[model samples]
Target: MVVPAQGLPASVRIHEVGARDGLQNEKAVVPTEIKAEFIHRLAEAGLTTIEATSFVHPKWVPQLADAERLFPLLDDIEGVALPVLVPNERGLDRALALGADRIAVFASATESFAKANLNRTVDESLGMFAPVVARAKEQRVHVRGYLSMCFGDPWEGAVPVHQVVRVAKSLMDLGCDELSLGDTIGVATPAHVRSLLAALNEEGVPTSAIGVHFHDTYGQALANTLAALQHGVTTVDASAGGLGGCPYAKSATGNLATEDLVWMLQGLGIDTGVDLGRLTATSVWLAERLGRPSPSRTVRALSPDSHKE
Candidate 1:
């Protein structure tokens, strides 16, 4: 069996989408400046990729309703890529006007989710985004596509593999720098992950073009990530403090915790380029500000090995 290879990465690129993906579903409205500070701390911790906020209307997602104001505060950082979620032309316009260096467009794998989330068919959603991707390309802004419900869906049971490939191909064909495959309901298993990656590989999809985003709803997030790593997938999306959920999928939980993913990767001798200890501290700080215990099991574990204390 293959492994993630020993030692540290020259530098692993982890795009912390927690502020956007992780916090979007939250009930509380985090202050705009506070969100800026949260992202600042993430960068200070060496996370080069951070998804700051979505350019969607506040009525749709009140948590990230501050995408416009939040954009400028996070832009001056030199090394980090502050990609905002552009829901359509209007959203894309806002991002471009703000000089966003990178942007993310989203589409779902199933029909029900398409209507519920995007109010359009899958094909329609892709068609709508073609121009957006072109515009981003024209302006030299990096584009990333998010394919939601690549695994099981809350409304549609047992997602077919073909559906995932179709959307992936559409996104990549449209010039997206990368495509993030999301297990929206956290219903994926390692077996499912391996099969999907294999299919994508056989279809000539570069692993470099792929990124995995999982939720630990059933506690299998790390196991699924291990499968992705074994397949030579380099990029992974994680959330600090594991803050996030599917806005439409009510049962969904937080993302695969960044602290948890880092803890496991470091333990396996893989090169993630992250300081797990500092990540733990950051998680603690975020949880305090959010007034909740962190969902990261690894963060909790390091909290005074009562035996050691």
Candidate 2:
């Protein structure tokens, strides 16, 4: 059933965000032990790049407050990149003190999201990230810049491709090793996705350095992903079991499920180094703990209960 696509890359690197982005928005705090176990399970399931947690102030995101405690338990995990999100210099310092070699900085592509998420304007947020990116690069740590609201903003409505390109170029200028373009509100169609990617390329942002993070709000995540793949984007950001959305953006919904993405990649004969069975099992186990079934269609279809009724 595997059909090789003509333009798609031979392999894609899935930037798993289930451990960090997935759990961060939870109303009920997932215990530190469970979070660590979840990460271990994800790693065991063959995800090489897993976002671990955020180092932002506890007051802002109380769910992931145990980042310091949760990060150490994962030290024993080898061969997987454990990247943490750092909001500012203090967050970066805390991550560095704990021996973190990979970190990500979040940026907003619109003024409204910048004010809501970071409490600063777009340019000011970039200024804040400048030092953090510089210091991380100085220490040879890998840095990823996440640009939110790339396709559309809840408050700003449809974002212009030029506006997104401006912010994206600023993030890359900050010495980031990679940039993840976020469709935060899930309002993007395939044509919009292609337009933005082409604009970024025109502005000198190479496809190799860009990753796509899509939300499934309008059910266009997979379609938009295919558009990116056609444009040669190889890194995709997905959450396990379709777990997370932007806590700040009320209209935002769960991210594109990793299980679903894996299924499509498997069908396309693209290698992602993921074992679908093990990953589904992991999501099922976590779902039981959370008292809800996974939102991922692939997970539900592949789970043991899929045969029931």
Please report, in order, the local distance difference test score of every candidate based on alpha carbons: 0.85, 0.96
TM-score for each model: 0.94, 0.98
For model 2 the local lDDT of residue 308 reads 43
Prediction 2 global C-alpha lDDT: 0.96
lDDT of 2 at 172: 98
| Per-residue accuracy of model 2 over 101-185 as CA lDDT, tens digit each | 9999999999999999999999999999999999999999999999999988988899998999999999998899999999999
Counting only residues 3 or more apart in sequence or on different chains, how many pairs clash (N, Cα, C under 3 Å) in candidate 1? 4
Instruction: Kindly give the stretch of ten consecutive residues in candidate 1 with the minimal lDDT sum.
Output: 1-10
**Candidate 1 ranges beyond 4 A from true positions:** 1-11, 304-309
Error of model 1, residue 8, in angstroms: 11
